[model samples]
Target chain A: MKEGRETTGGIEYVVGAEKGIREIVRDEDVMPLLESALSAGASRVEVTDSRGGTLWACGASSGNNDSATVERRPVFLEGEPAGSLVVEASPGSQLRLNDLAGLLCAALNKIITNSLKRMLTTEIHTSVVNRTYEELLETNKRLRASESRYRELAENLDRKVQERTEELKRMHTRLIQQEKAASIGLLAAGVAHEINNPIGFISSNLNTLKRYISRFTEMMDFYRAAIEEADKAGGGITEAACRKWSDLKLDFIVRDVEELISQSLDGAERVRKIVSDLKGFSHVDDSKEDIVDLNTEIERTFNVLVHEIPEDAEIVKEFGSLPGFLCNPAMICQVFLNIILNSLQARRQGLKLHVSTKHVDGNITVAFSDNGPGIPEEVRNRIFEPFFTTKDVGAGTGLGLTVTLDIVTAYGGDIEVTSCPGKGTTFVIRLPAERREHVKVR
Target chain B: MIEFDRTEKRMVLKLVFYGPALSGKTTNLLRLHDLLSREGRGELMVLDTRDDRTIFFDLLPFFLVTPGGLKIKVKVYTVPGQVKHDATRKAVLQRADGVAFIADSRVSEVANNYSSFENLEKNLAFVGIDIERIPLVIQFNKRDLSDIVPEADIERVWRPTGIPVFMASALEGWGVVETFSRLVELTYDSIDGKCGLSEGYGLDREDFVGRLTKRVQGS
Candidate 1:
């Protein structure tokens, strides 16, 4: 399709879609070219559309005369003709014209060229400004949307943060519960055996007392028979009754029955006390604030862990003048249980735990120092972290010291650990006696 | 790559010289208008200006007609480099066949050069042209001046980008022809391989570039 059309070439390029001659060429721009051409000695000059519609004309019209000369040159844009410039004059004026039509058409073409270029430049500049403005509008809309979203998040921040903190506190309690369940379950295994001993001795004492009662009844019947016989034969039957009473062993039965009854009561009381210890330890989860004796709590914890304590293990209690501390009795006992259990498991043989409690400077101080294979520096530092265990996989839940730390801190207290690695490890726990509340966990 | 009317035997290709203010874009066009033979080119038209600064643009047209009478016209343009003239820049940048980025080489104009490059990239996209695939060259102009970025440092930084870069003192007419020759050659290749001009007519690469750069053919 390479049709050879000579090009005058373009000085300006169009950015968007091209505009037609009718759209680009304005009335005001063409009037001057026509007037200028007419002033240059042409009888008539006219601009025509591609379809030969006259858009502008100047000077008188040339009639249908045979000698009239009509000079027409196409008005071009980008080498494509959009319209034509026609210059008309009488025959005698043609030579005097000196190709005046040519010169004027060139002038008209230049005007069209400059006009089209201005139109294109202006059109494209307008398009760019409009597009940029639209883009700015869209960007402003997005910025406003983002601002409101961030503002909403900021408004809800504090309440949401507090909610999360409370949730974490509840989770922490559950973790301590799970860990405490392990130790409590172990101690419960000892409870039945602990109660079974008193039950056995009490039943034996009751049976012995029953046999003594029967022998006394038999002696009484013999005495009644002897008395009846004596009425009939005075002094003769009295010897048989005395013989029967001697065989019955009446004096020993009376003394031994009293002792057996007292001993049986003691055995029942021992069984009752064991049941109460079981109840106290089992209810730790629901433990509430109360007047607490921390020393009593330590002793009770040892009693509950009686089955796990080795026979040769020694516990030295250095009792100090500790006043009654207001705290949760069951929860405090759990704290004591965790620490004492650590001392118990530290060594099996020659395990010596020194536990002491005292009141000092408006605070209660409780310490348990164990003379076992002492904690290593690294292990001691991490012991209070939950699930950090030195014991074998199933042998430890690893939350023992963590629970102890949580409980102590909940009572407005703190715990400190010191270890020499080989000699022993000591844990010092301090609880403020007054001017304190449960510390909020962040 | 605007007009490719095969039936009309005319192909109009556009090239734009883009850069920061006073970075020698118009200078490159002026030098090219001077050096390129007038036989293949039309008159150079420089539009509105105030105080010798280009407010609109500068345009020069060059056409090459083959033996078969197929006319391939290359129109080179330079956009006004002032930041206030961004709209005009975007308008002139539309449908560009190739681009030569003329950057100021002065140490103080480094940030201005970078921002103008970004402006080029953004406006190219606005005109629906992809900067990645366009045949583009970078000319660090004003290299004769002291305190310009050293050529070694420029190469070290720009070599990895794979875009061809040139050093020039455009005011003194040092590297203008070389930069233009490379851009025109790249544009010819791109049209042949990617822009679908090869399907219409096979372009004579050596003759086309040799004629534009005023070099002997077959060199």
Candidate 2:
């Protein structure tokens, strides 16, 4: 198939079936060339493809003429036969037929080679471009998948972090609850003693009253016996009955019995009042948030801590008419109790705690000022941190301020501490008077 | 890493040429294909774009037979040097026994070379191949071009890394074989140390090198 027609080199190359004589050889190109060949004395001329299909034809006779001389030259495309040209010689014509056929063959080969080159380059370009486009599509799909995966991971991590933080907050609240229970347990011992003193006096008075009642009953029995004896003797008084009445001292017993009964009733009333105070101060159902007076809860907390306060300690109250705000009553009481207890612990003698409440700028601020040895500057900053304490381990769980801060902030309130060494300390708590939507259980 | 089949008495190894775009990675392979004896190697397979630029990869395979009849086959590959062809480069670098980093020697390409080298290090780590432990050789290609960096400057900066460096004009076929030979030796030693190829399998070092590096006729 190497016809030595390709312009690059002598190497052989195969042309595809797609490149046919019909596509390359147009009628305009072949007709003029063939007409000139015939005028130069060739009688007939015909062009056919590789498969011998006629592309262009001009014949002198319809059938094959055996008298005419024929010259056939195969046209080559990319060093392969693509078509052929046939010229029949006319008789007695002075034309160089060999030179004419040679020129026509060379012209046809050049055109086919040129067309083949263009077609091959175009095919390679389109195919390569198509493959690259497909690869790019696949790459884009993979990148999208990867991006979604990363986004999913990030979102999952965020959820996990939130869950962990919520769990920690719950654990923190439980710790505070346990600390409050421990403090209550400590206060209960003191409360029992306070109630027991009145109970003891009431029990003693009841025993004395029992003896007085028996004395009165014995005097009545003697009087009844004397009356019976007199009736039997026809309404005459007996001397033995009269002597017993005189020896028993009935007049003094009557006066002492009335006094005993009155004293017993007074002691019983004292015991009842003490028990009622204990019940009111430790209201266990005061867990849920409700609209309550801050001053009232503070007074109840003061009552609960009465037994623990030193004998000469003075508690001063400056009350303002604050509107009821949403709060957990027990938690608010615990907050006041913790501050008072700390004030009591800081000073053993001549301690004064001034508690005040005010409504200003739509907020209620409760302040507790103590004239005890205030917190030093170095230890003041870490007071709200959990497990930070200056007291002995058994005396403090160190979560008092921490719990106070947590509960206050949960109700959308904030606490500020002002202290100076050896002077006084004040804890001011500011709370919004209205219930907020984001209030949480601490 | 390469596969050594004891049952079949055959070993297969791979070497990859890696560098930035148009930095002579394919040129190095083409030069080796021209210089090496045809009996020792297979045909070079190039997957190129319409403009004759390599878009995927090129492969040239070579074989060697030790004196003790242990057959060894080595496949040399060139990854597409374009930045976007990272996936193809990683695929070709898999299980490669050695790497020849072909850097451009022109002054303007110095930054590109360094960045590509950094990319190589990052990709090696991502593929779980320790760049510190892998057998590697650096080749400054296109040395015959004008405005190239001085050999002294390259050596001064690279000597501290302790990797062997060579300057090559891949278009002219000079220094190509030397770079190839050094990488082959390094690969052989690493494989030998890992699998006891020399002690247990009776593989001779010089015999393996000689079989692959023999010159072709009239080259």
Candidate 3:
């Protein structure tokens, strides 16, 4: 890769000694040396100077013979010019005194040129090495900066990954808790209905037994009055009291007792109807899909939680005429139960829970709202996040809204919450009106 | 390592004045332009500027003819001292035979001086001029300013480099000629070796120096 060339020229050096010689000798010496050598027909000339014991020589010769031999000898500087040289002559040789001077000039020029070349080459080589070293230093600096940047990016990435992993762990824990709470809700609804059934019949049987005791007591009172009148009439009246008791139809009274028992049996049948209605309200069978009435589920959740709400709180329901929705009835019911219970818990005092359902835009929109201290601005955005709750730590698990959101999303629905700090909070849940075939499998 | 030809026997030597921002590179050129004999030198040509600042460069051309008929023309150039004008600096440094680095001597400017020196080295390489091969002289300028950097520290740093160093206040016109003379001597020796000016052209070193010095002082 030869790229370019560099050339230089200038005046740089001085020859000949001027210190111990007269100015005229120093100036006149070179001219005579040239003239004497030319007059000798040698076609060449030489000069030597010895000052401060330093040997300096100038020599010149001319020749045309390609292989001409020339003598080589040492030149000495003294009172007289002393230097040795040989000249070769042949036909057509263009050798002259002036030519000798030119040749000497050329030889001396070679010496100076060679010396300068060595110096410039050395300098150029050193400069190139220095430049290369400086470039290497710059490159090394850039590489170190790049390495540090990559290290910082890697550290930031690792920290972000760790934060995301922790978030995933919390979500997993919330999912487990939601599943447990859903199961518990199903159990409570079923047990409440089961206990209602036995109590209904036992109360009805006790009421029938009281009515029979009253009728038998009236008949005994009539017999006691007739026996007292006969005893007052005389000694022979005992037979008349016995006849009066017979006339009062004691046999008929025994037949009437059997009729009373039959009536009590009818009343017990009415009690059975009430118990069956209670069972219908609490559907506990956990299956993939079930046809459920939205209105009925809302009513049942309200009934179950009515006693738990504060006394000052009011519950309002606005139910629409909606067709039965095919869904995972247990899960849907659990979602309603959790939301309503959460509303009750959020109430401070004088709370109002308004639950409204409507069919609109091919979906059933169930809106549950409460008038209480609404969710604060800071925590409102995170209401559906697991473990984010305003309730006291042990009293509420904070998974209620999170589970509600998950169930709604799983059903291809959405739930939105709106709250104003001093006003109230409202949650709107939208579920698909028509069940899709794919939803039944999962 | 940069080269030019003188086909007409009139060779021009290029010397560059380079340094950090506000280090008086332009001031040195101005002083030389003002003091040198007008008859022996061309008019100082300053390439356009912005707000009296040398944005490109300043040039002062001079001519010296030896008794033996060798004509030597020396061109002195001063690069813009602003750090961002590196392209201009590099352009001016091309074919440079010698350099004078005008460093700022204020105590706060020590780092700037080093950075500028490094920049000079880079620019020189870009122009294909080997920094070590080209005769280099360090000129610490702005000595008139109080709180100047310590002289000992500057000497200690530059001594090992083996290049001539001089303290100057270009504003006061002190030590400027000494700095210029040192570069001239180095430049002459370097170019002489290459051209065989003394042996081939019969141009002696004393005659050349005497003429250059007389031209510089006669202005």
Candidate 4:
């Protein structure tokens, strides 16, 4: 397959590198020609190469010694002396012997040249075939190596895509949690107010109780002083002691003290309730699950958001009996909280939040409806999209509805929003009654 | 380049028609055989299956003798375009001086076209041919069919490569000669640059192109 080499008529003719002499001019072919020449009056004949390698001998050349060799002809192949033939005959037959030698030499030259040509062609053909086969093998090996590399890449591509998708999902969940935490941080003031009210009254009630104890101590001190004085005067009651006891108003003090103690206990209980509600709202271990009542989660959300809600707005809960379903309670609480907050924020006053839960047809539907200005038709569809907000920037993080949708869908539930302009907005969420152990939504 | 026998005053140049399966690589050669005159061309030898698919290759020999008696012979070959015939393809593409890449024009075959082109590049590199140096012509064949890729889109995609692009329906005999002639011209110029075809052998580019692209006397 190289260039600049001679291949005229598809043969690479070589010179002077004869492989086998006997293979070119066989003795059998030369002997027949020689015998015919002898019959035509030739005495003897023999053929040999330039190096004296014999190809054929007959008649006198066979050592009969009957005739002297008088004539000789050189065989030429491609203008090169390959061999020569000699003929022995009588003087009268020398001309015929010369002609016979020429004819035999010519025949021998044609045979040798044709044989060499055939050999060259065969050699070129074998070389070409062998080289092509070798190249094909080398090419096949390289192709197989490249093919396996591509196959490995293709196989790993699927796995890489899956792993990346899983990683992105984890990152998205983490981002949502961070956003939720930030929003809660912004609402800390309202939470502080909720806890502070009960604590404030509890501390005031304890002060009042302390003053009542002081009054009792003073009365006891006066009574002891009067008794001691009476003993000194032969155990008699005096006008000064009677005046002091009357001034004390002991009956009124006992009644007021009992009331003060009861009020203080109630304030303490209120403070404990607020703290418990806050603890439940900040459920950080959302991966864990328990058999939860959706209605209970909603009520807890209401408790946590009590101070955040406007004073005029009323929350009406129409709870229906439902069987407990297994779920991550914290996530459900977040969803309920988002919905309730949206309802409470719909109006500054005269906001009626209607929350209802019902179990029917193996599905539980929790609907939160508010009688306030409804979501616009254009914005209604995009409400659940991440980072979609209707509230002013600092008031809402825009992840509330998106996170709600994610949690609900992850639990094999779906949420739908129906809002009519100037009427109200209702968010209806449906969940499967049966527990699904491993449900992946979206 | 296949063989340049200086002693014989003969240069055997090789050109290959490559593409995805059923994109009509063989049909391009057949069309060229039909269009070109017999004075400088040989018989088209096709090694095909009974189903009309190329099994090994197709060879179409072309010849050109310059005024100075310099003989230039071009052997045109088409490899089996099926994906499983990679070995046959590599063997056929051993030393190609030029190539014509025929592609399916159907919109649905975009992926197949890209994949086949990548395969061609890989195989060409394996055979030790530099794709950037070798003269290449692209043919968006099967333009006669419906739902074909738009010519404008083809231009937009292939224009930056600076390779000549042809849209042809080989079966209908349109754009085939143009593609063949352009490829022959490019191949001649490239070889001329490398080995001095005109300066050393008096092989003029136009004369060679004219001889090969000459229309047949009858059909």
Q: Which stretches of candidate 4 lie over 4 Å from their true place?
A: A1-107, A208-260, A435-437, A440-442, B1-219
Ranked candidates (lDDT, high to low) = 1, 4, 2, 3
Docking class of 1: incorrect
For model 1, which pairs clash? none
Q: Identify the runs in model 2 with alpha carbons over 4 angstroms from their true place.
A: A1-119, A206-272, A434-438, B1-105, B110-146, B150-219
Candidate 3: lDDT of A344?
A: 70
User: For residues A1-442, could you state the per-residue lDDT of candidate 3 as single tens digits?
Assistant: 1113332111111111111222222324344544554464544443433222323322344544343323233332211112333333333445553455445444433333333334333443454455456557778999999999999999999999999998976876567455546546554565566456555655665675576566556556755765687578645455755565566554665676666566556656644644443344434445557778989878766655544667788888899987788876656766887877777767757889898999987899999988867888898789889778777766667777777787788788899889887888898999888856445322
How much is A233 displaced in model 2, in angstroms?
9.2
The whole-model lDDT of each prediction reads: 0.79, 0.77, 0.66, 0.78
- Which prediction has more favorable DockQ, 3 or 4? 4
List chain B TM-scores, each candidate.
Answer: 0.94, 0.95, 0.92, 0.97
When summed lDDT is taken over every stretch of 10 residues in candidate 4 chain A, the lowest stretch is: A9-18
Regions of candidate 3 where Cα sits further than 4 Å from its true position: A1-94, A107-318, A321-331, A343-354, A369-393, A405-426, A431-442, B1-114, B118-138, B141-165, B168-219
Worst 10 residues of 2 chain A by lDDT: A7-16
Among all candidates shown, the one with the greatest lDDT: 1
**Candidate 3: deviation at residue B188, Å?**
23
lDDT tens readout by residue for model 2, A1-442: 1122231111112112124566765578668877887777777888887677878877583354444366789976434355788777766556666777888777766665555445544544454455456567878999999999999999999999999998998898799888788778878898788878767867887787777678667877977877887788766455775566567766776777777677767777776766666666655655667788998988888877888888899989999999997767777777877888888899989999899999999899999999989999999999999999999978899998888888888878899999988988999999888856666664
Ranking by TM-score: 1, 2, 4, 3
- lDDT value, residue A299 of candidate 2: 84
Per-residue lDDT for A1-442 in model 4, tens only?
Answer: 2353333322232111224556655567567888987888776777777777767877764433343446677875433455677777755454455567677777776666666556544543454465567667878999999999999999899899999999999987786787668656745667777768767877887887787778778878977887888788766566766676567776777897788778778878887887777677767644577788888888888888888788888888999999997887777887888888788788878898898999999999999999989999889889988889989977787889988888888888899889988889999999989956676422
* Worst ten in a row by lDDT for model 3 chain A: A10-19
State the fnat of model 4: 0.09
